[model samples]
Target: MRGGPYLLLLVAGTLGVGRGLDGQLGSPCHPSGRCNVRFSECQDNICRCSGTGVPSAYNNRCLPVADGLKGYCEENVQCTVPHSHCRRFSKECECVEGYVMARDRSVCLPVSRLGEPCLERAQCKESTECSPSLGVCVCRGISYEYDGKCVTDHISNNWELTVVTVSPAAGSQLLAHNRWLLCIALAALVHAGVR
Candidate 1:
């Protein structure tokens, strides 16, 4: 009976062989069948997800490919269920309004020109020129608007034309003057030759 006190002290001082207050076996995963390799913890059952699959080191989630699929979320975060898009750099998923998937399927863009209200040159198409007053890009042929209606032409006010007229009477008078001078010169030359 004297050894009973010493044995009790030895059992109390035992290391790594006692059960938790809740009687959990070893770790939460061993008893609950759920493990979080990424977080290195037995799930507290709050966000209960099966950790049986491949473990992810980055997010510590069940799936190994949760972060992204390479270039798809390079600059942007990977798209999640609630978020429309994922931005890789910021690591956030957000919804982009008025922007739809482009033809290439890699980028999201506005549906049409009307979708974006253009107030500057950069917002217009390459062929179009921006008119800030109207807050949109007008095509080359599209006329500018005055009041409420479109003006067919907004030509520069400095344009001018020179009017030229041909007078046959003036031409005939000049021709006669030339003939009189020629005859007088011819007469003088003949007189000098005779001398």
Candidate 2:
């Protein structure tokens, strides 16, 4: 963004990574500062980007920052995902406590139990928590994980969340569980800046 169009072409001419462009993210570079990659510098023997330039989970690529859940950031201001903020450890946009990315990936919504999707334990509703292996809301304590809501005596608490009572309905959710996990993993890769 600093230079004219010809400057991009000149920098793009460098070889070995990212469309053969020097200063292209994740490309190997020297200790001497290179003007090609913006907001990036050679660190730990690799060309790493800072700020909006996010590295992939594999650290293979760097992507421009955005306001989505996958956007790379160091501060809360960098992300604008609904009900979301920058997570310090991951350095990416994530839902605030008591919230998680919706199934549609558009917004962060309150977390509930009984198969509602979640990323962390705090997102789950009371008496429930996010399951690390399953990536869905699961019952805690003495509750049962039936339908889309947890129950103590198999009695519905009458939660507004979509409820399923039939055996087939619960069976169908098995596939959904896998799908949610896949989505979470993909989001993580993109969150790391795979884009």
Candidate 3:
């Protein structure tokens, strides 16, 4: 009977001592990045970060970039460019010149998806591809190379590059269009040294 009491006391003491040492009672430091308001615990069962880009912590846990956005990022695998938000249409994260993050985490989406049609190579879906381009899935081609293999280029001209630039007027909307023409014009002026 004395042995049973001693065993119970020992167990209770051990538990009490652990509670004192940890000081949380049961709430430990939750991972910042790992928690999305749904699950806040890092210990028992939590989703681990796994993405090609650099791992980042939000709540307390490290998070990897989301899938389908593999090599289009520089820092946070989810982002194509630094500080840029991931585009759902292209699956590439790019920062538009003027847009900022909204309360719902929505980023600025340009008309590029509507103007230029790209499917398969650039990760653009078939139905989403723009017209006249007859955007169709094809083998990875020219502009971008994946895994030592060059992805296919649906656009025939390399002169076509979509760049988002802020308009001159104050509070003017940003435009996503061909930057090649501007570069060429600038180059011509530079060569001629126009005033």
Candidate 4:
């Protein structure tokens, strides 16, 4: 009876040690078992999965790393698309600024210039508008019409005019006119290197 109790205790200790070793040697994944990429682990003798990093559609199965633009990704390193970035919130790759997602969502393309076809505002360059009715980008509002394009009037022309409106409560017509004359005089002085 003394030997039997000792053997039982020994067996229990060996089983505890075996379980500890399993924890150290067991893989989070198992062969022939499906799991979301790096997002799941085997737990409690079952393939337990979570949805935190895995999309709902892929939560039930293992999915290969995406290879193109706008593809699902866990990190930027996994995205193979050119000029793209991984958005953690959406778990997908997206194009950087000055670029647009292609129609197929497989690549990033340079933004359309003036008069080019555009499907969205992001498809056009800055200070340009995508005309929904015309199906092309156009520059409007104080922009100069150039050779089949639009350019900033003030910047490209190298000059700008500032209009100052005087409030009627602050000044009479004559006073406003005097303020304009003073502004013109100051501008002339600066132009002639007199200031």
Q: Can you give the TM-score per candidate against the true fold?
A: 0.24, 0.30, 0.20, 0.35
Per-residue lDDT over 1-195 for candidate 1, one digit per residue giving the tens place of the 0 to 100 score: 999999998776543222222323223333333333333334453322343333333333443222322223322323432325555465544346645443334344342352245544544553454566776656535555444334443333222233446498976775687988656555555544522
Best by TM-score: 4
lDDT of 3 by residue, 1-195 (tens): 779999998887655431212322123333332323232233433333333323332433333455332324323445633346655566555555543332233433332332243432333332233233466333222234334333333233333334456558622322225466566755655544443
Which segments of candidate 3 are over 4 A away from where they belong? 1-27, 30-62, 66-77, 99-195
- Mind giving the per-residue lDDT tens digits that candidate 4 earns over 1-195? 779999998987655441222332232444344333345555553444343332224334334456677677776655657888788799888888778887788778778988888887768875677888998888866675576677654332544445678688655765665887777757755654554
Ranking by lDDT: 2, 4, 1, 3
lDDT string for model 2 (1-195, tens) is: 667787877766544333313445566655554535556667754677765566645454555666588667866655757688888898988888877786666678786666877776766876787888999878887877666656675433332233456588766786577888656656555544545
lDDT winner among the candidates?
2
Off by over 4 Å in 2: 1-67, 113-149, 152-195
Off by over 4 Å in 1: 1-45, 48-116, 119-123, 140-195
The alpha-carbon RMSD values of the candidates against the true structure, listed in the order shown, are 20.9, 22.0, 20.2, 13.8
Worst 10 residues of 4 by lDDT: 18-27
Model 4 spans with C-alpha error above 4 angstroms = 1-73, 77-83, 87-92, 101-110, 152-195
- Per-residue lDDT, model 3, residue 152, is 39
CA shift of 170, model 1, Å? 20
Give the clashing residue pairs of candidate 2, or none: none
- For model 1, which pairs clash? 38-60, 76-86, 76-87, 76-88, 77-86, 77-87, 77-88
